[model samples]
Target: MDFGFTDEQKILRQTFKKFCEKELTREYVAWMDENCDFIPDELYKKLADLGLFGMIIPEEYGGSGMTFTDYMIAMEELSTASVAAGICAGLAVSFGAKVIGGMGNEEQRRFHLPKMAAGETKYCLALTEPGGGTDIINAMKTTAVKKGDNYVLNGQKVFISGGNVADYMLVVALTDPKAAKRTKAMSVFVVDAKTPGITVNLIKKVCIHACGTTEIFFEDVVVPAENMLGVENNGWNKLVDVLNPERIGTAMLSLGIAKAAYQAAHEYSLERYAFGKPIGSFMVLQHYLADMLIEIENATNLIYKCCYLMENGLPYHMEAAMAKIVAGRASEIAAIKGMEILGGYGVCMEYDLQRHFRDYKQMVFSPISDEMAKNMIAQWTGLPKSY
Candidate 1:
């Protein structure tokens, strides 16, 4: 099958790439890193003007109504600019707007979709707890108890991306403890960040410094029944079904970070001369550059194929898992090679390679781990997956 972009897709990529070059330049990323701030308000507004937040939403819902492939194009371009900036926008559009648009009621969609797509609101997912890191199914401690006409939620969510500044939250909670044996009885609820008894505490981290990670506390926080995304005690399917797209987005993010590192390394080798010629002329440096290219291409192909299969309605769980797993390693390899090219300069914050290195490492652990992905592949492909 031909994996080439159509004329329209090509134009879309060109448009988004130009936008990134114009708005999200290397200097802009440096400023953000220095300040330790989220993407500026004006930048977010510019993205809204571009209809970026609506990239994947349906036109009927006041969105551009584009396909996942189109959204992937946008994701890649924005990510190539800055992973923090791109994800700050992409997650709000895909996991936040797309998830809500797909399942929310008409009233819910009418009110939330337009604002989200317009960049007036942002969202965060509250799935991981302090105690439950990877064993999310059996380790969830958050509870949303039905009381009268509202559900009173009581729990804490840690390492919540976009939590500190998000206007809305998609919280996963258990509805029943007994029937959770098979898949775990969990449900998703949308809660406004301003709701009473809800607290957002910022989390200090080494990477994604521009993005806000937080610990959220729900102490008798009330959520109306209208806000439930799926059936009571049946939210596991909703959560799991959404993982494919999320994982794809993350793998793409990793690819972007790798590309950033590759560019830095490539440029450094060319300019840094040693002995009688540039370091890039040396065989050892040439070997590293070749290895970096191979890793990037392999990861990129896997990620695209997974997305293509999912869009075409195929069983692609194993493929998606593999893409995410491999891409994480690819990211680390690129960053390490890039740093080697820069030597000590790569570790300094003034250059993009240091931030890229820190950012790529974080991407390696998120959504899922490499060992977990191998286990899933083993179960599905009968290949005896082992760590």
Candidate 2:
């Protein structure tokens, strides 16, 4: 089988890599991470100008309507420079392309797609709750009741990325907690973030500080019936479509962080001197960097292949889970080894490695934890359900 980026994909990568080199210098990225919890408006606008916020949107909606592989390619490249920046783009792109473009009704599509494509709108997803993550559906306490012509929602969502800054939120809630089939008891709503009774509070975290995580409270928020996505009480069917891509995207995030960490550690090893010579001369340091590169390359290949399978209409869930698991571990290892290689400098604010060291950790449990991925993978491989 041929294994290479298409000419267009290569150009896409080069263009984005250039953008990162020019606008996302290490110092600047670190500054944003230190001082901001949301993407700066100017930088967000620049990303829009670069077409990152609309790559997967249909051309008719003013988007490129690109393939999943292309989205992954851009994600991996963007994350290499700054994962927080990449995440801001990722959430918007997925909401526009997947939710509105693929699952939204015609009116919803017409209303949201063009604005999202132009970066005139931003989005956040509220799926996880205070009670659970992997088992969120069964543990969900958020409820939505039909009222006249609208759905009145009352619930809380935690770990909502970019919620405070988003123009809209895709909320998952229980519409029929007593439904015989638990999977069909829930539905999704696209709600205005400024809707009355919606309260947002930011959650402080140690990594990826540039993109704030949040806990949101919806106290009888009213949403029109037209805003419900897909068939009512069948959000699980639709959510799967949104989530598989997110898993693959998470893998790309890990690979990007690994790439950044590896570069920092490699450069530092050659420049930092100890025992009258460069640290590069030490065999142990060489092994650390070498292993790190191997993990990054291996994880990258797996991630890309998963994206390709998804783009080509092949079964990709198992592979997506595996990719997330492999890439997350790879990134965690690369970050730790990066810190080890940089020694004390790894923890210092002036060194990018420290950011890499701190930031590579979120993926270990986000989107889907590595442990959760393993649980699903085990079942896929003919093992009994373990979780």
Candidate 3:
């Protein structure tokens, strides 16, 4: 029932907000969006120094061991400055570090977690494939076969963020294709990016340019047996931990984008005079802003609620889906509304509102599409499967 943050949590929020305000200004990120396909190494190292990369990792593994709420707070603040920052940071912590902390064994943790926390290592999760974007388990075609002393992998993974720059990649593949169910035989491997026969091809994306997306190909890429995460043929159950955090993080990023767009439009409305008065003074524009605020608040509440449920170790599958669906729509509306208010200026690359509009659209389809999220909700509520 508590709606307030603890002192430590408040400090976390302030720290990231201050950091974003200083480092992720509109001019800086707009430049990055135009020129770079990934966050520069220096900036990535700086974020690692700020302890952002260690939030989800356990203290035993050289991390801060913070709660998921703290992670959500950090996401919201960083996203307010730029969704790319939020996404990159989230990818490092939620998808990368957690893969080792939650699923990897002691040796793996001791070897990988410290470097991950220190930003000495970067990671990408390679799960999505050419035809398996949504119906991942059933459509998975990647295979890893046992060799004399290694597992030789042959498959492809698409839409992987930071795939080109990662020091390591957590890959999912079928270890037993003959199993009764595809979900029963999947396995996860932490493969070195330099492994032989691995190729990363950059995919041109219009949004979140700084975060980099790519498709990875593995042809006889040999991975050591020791690099396997969790038990053999049990990755499907364990992967949910990573997937759930990803959804919540995605929702938090959506909230941040919504806030950013709304803030930009709000400032413009008060200052831009029209017909002898501020445009904000007009009831129609005011109503749009009001609606934007309402949706933003609603999404914020649900995302934080998901954070709470996660921190408490409760089942959050349904809540995460709902949060994802609501937050995605809220961010989309805010971006569109901000664009409408800014008029001709919004479409120009000179303004940050357009960046928000473009970057925020990715949330609608990523992690899981809103339509897919709703379908998950339908199943959770005992409805017949629609697809």
Pairs in steric clash, model 2:
none
- Over 1-387, each residue of candidate 3 has an lDDT whose tens digit, in order, gives 789999998999899888888888778888889988888788888889889898878888888988888878887888888888788887788788877788999999999998898889988999999986889988899999999879999999999999978889999999999999778889999999999899999999889999999999999999999999999999988988657778888888898889999999999999899899998999989988998999999999999888888878888989989888888888999999999888899999888898999888899999898888889899989999998
Query: On a 0 to 100 scale, what is the lDDT of residue 136 in model 2?
Result: 89
TM-score of each: 0.96, 0.98, 0.98
lDDT of each: 0.84, 0.88, 0.89
Ranking by lDDT: 3, 2, 1
lDDT string for model 2 (33-97, tens) is: 98999879899988888888778888887888888888788788789999999888888976555
For candidate 3, the lDDT comes to 0.89
lDDT of 1 by residue, 76-154 (tens): 8888788888778866875688678766778888888889888899888888998966788778888989988889899
Better of 1 and 3 by lDDT: 3
Choose 1 or 3, whichever is better by TM-score. Answer: 3
Cα error, residue 184 of model 1, in Å, equals 4.4
User: Which parts of model 2 have CA positions greater than 4 angstroms off?
Assistant: none
